[model samples]
Target: MTAKVALVTGATQGLGLALVEGLAARMSTEDTVYLTGRDAGRVAQAVEALPAGGARVRGEVLDVAGPHEAGRLAERLAERHGGVDIVFGNAVMRVGPEDDPREIVGAYAEVNNFGTTRLLRAFAPLLRDGGRFLVVASSFGTLNHLAPALHGRFDGLSSLDEVDKQVAVWRDAVADGSARGGDWPGFVNIPSKIGQVAAVRALAGERREADLARDILLAAVCPGMMNTPTSAMWWDVRDAPSPAQAAEVLLDLVFRPVDPAQYGGLVRDGEVLPWR
Candidate 1:
């Protein structure tokens, strides 16, 4: 019997590395897991750092966000096992230095949103009939908490929704209007308290191949602001979970009964979040 193989991207440190460890712990006797990163050295480090008695794990170098790298990974996997059984898109970029509201719109969208689109495009087809797809996202994607309370009024006017409608209502409030200094409203109240997590939701909403491809497990997990070098101020954040704990909580989902084929679209904090 051929062993099931799993590929985890950005398996260097933080949530990615922790997940690699946890998955290794759960691998069956005839299973293999591969950890991948952009750099060869980092991949080596990830392989060496595998849990003491985890599965027979190995590491490879592949930047999932790049065409060349993803292609090479596809080639290697096809040659080795014909296709992969699982893919953990557990890589992301949070806010920039000091969580600058200024960079939130562009930088975060570029890395967190579009980058994911590119990676999924590259690897979704390589998944075997029963492969799982897990994407590491943030709690920010919830979009349910965009309260009018947080985002303050612009030019002395309140209501965050108004700003959102600025493009439609005011006709160019973004270009020639009082919405100038307040470029990114996140500074005032961070309306998108859950947009990052919502990105996973959005992708699942738009395209739910992971769940549909096979009897596969598909999830979008919020690792919970764990103590990771993800951001310099991780330690300062109020009680943060350990990467190991996050990993454990994430994997525990596999056992809990949920239709992998039905709700394979999204997962939040281990539960499948609404894609509606």
Candidate 2:
């Protein structure tokens, strides 16, 4: 039997590294898992630290936000593995309240939102039938974070184009100082995650037929409050779960059978939550 292939982005530390290790622990001699990070040295170090045993663990330098890198990585994976069996979209950027609003919003959107779309576009063709694409999202991404009007706009989105349009609206609001005027939260992270969930829903809906035909599944998941550098930098993580615990939840979903009803939905604590 051929070994399955898996890819995890931002695998240098925190949840990403934990997930890579957890997945590696479950693999057989034939399996291969790729660990990606912006820093080549870090990626190499991470790969070396994994106890993959007989399974092959490789490192790739990747900046998910880069325009050309995603495509290049996808092509390389295709040539090396024929196609990927699973993708864990875990790379993200966190912005604090004190940061410049415009820069935060732009950087978050580019990394968390557009970068995800770019990965999906580049890797979709390389995803074999019955493959899984999981986006690590957050509870804060729930539309309740926005005003009713904005909530409706985001919740009612039915396509990737609409999601892009909604993101553009938020970008415009940030640029014009309207995002601070009671209606918007003035924080970039929440909206960026909301865009991720929205994009998952839209992509799933648009690809429903293909998904069924190919047995492909897509989902957004919240790993809960973990004690990671990103969380520590922005909020209190004194009581948060360790990255290993969160990685277990993610790995459980990855190994379990796909549930069509939960496709394109948000999951937390191992339970699927309503998209709205």
Candidate 3:
């Protein structure tokens, strides 16, 4: 494979670490793979845990939701590597049942929703010709989560602004305590997941409109159910595959050349799921 520069956010553990490990094995020695997390020690440990490989694995301290960090990392990458070939937006906050709903609202709003927006804004331009940006999203993010009455509101979503409007509506509902019994999905994470997928679609459109010579492929991918710490927090994991197993599946898809039909879609197990 050609020397490529890749970045995977929240790579200290679980699926994120699995992705980094997979990439490290496939990449050439000249290639660079950056694994990032908010914690420096954990990031270092994750890098150290990787098996010996040709790829140059580096750890970066990055809080995707924190202000200006993604942009700064983008600048550094631009200066050092000219641009990046692959980006995996995998950082997320998974809320638990014991957590206070009010206290956790900002995490879902900022990390899951706007954190994705921030990653796209900072890294989209840095994608080299034929580069790919894949968001680690869930099937739950699909438009099927929306009520029938609200489906029309998201139709023909063509801009980030439109996605933001949808997020704002969810936020408003939450603030008013109407989200539970109203048109919105009861789970706070649902709207943010929807926002992530919608944002990826909108950004893909914007990239096409720019008409750049680069064929930058962008999409959201669901890695299916994994028996990771994060997954075990919410659901039964006995039937789920190990993080390494799911990573193998996901990396297989990532390494393949994606056709236009796959772009901007929510992919799972090599197939694009129905958005509507």
Candidate 1, 58-175: lDDT as tens digits: 8888764453666677777888888787777765555544664443444443344444545555566676766666667655444333345422322222222332332122223322
Error of 1 at 111 (Å): 3.6
Q: Which of candidates 1 and 3 reaches a greater TM-score?
A: 3
My TM-score estimates for the predictions, one after another, are 0.71, 0.93, 0.93
Model 1 regions lying over 4 Å from their true place: 94-110, 145-184, 187-213, 231-235, 255-265, 274-276
Top lDDT prediction, candidate number: 3
> Whose TM-score is higher: candidate 2's or candidate 3's?
3
**Each model's total of backbone clashes:** 12, 0, 0
Residue 45's C-alpha lDDT in candidate 3? 91
lDDT, model 3, position 22: 90
- Better structure of 2 and 3 per lDDT: 3
Best by TM-score: 3
Candidate 2 residue lDDT tens string, 103-202: 5677777788888877777876688877888899988778877667778767867877788788888877887777887577766777878888988888
- Cα shift from native, residue 145, model 2 (Å): 1.8
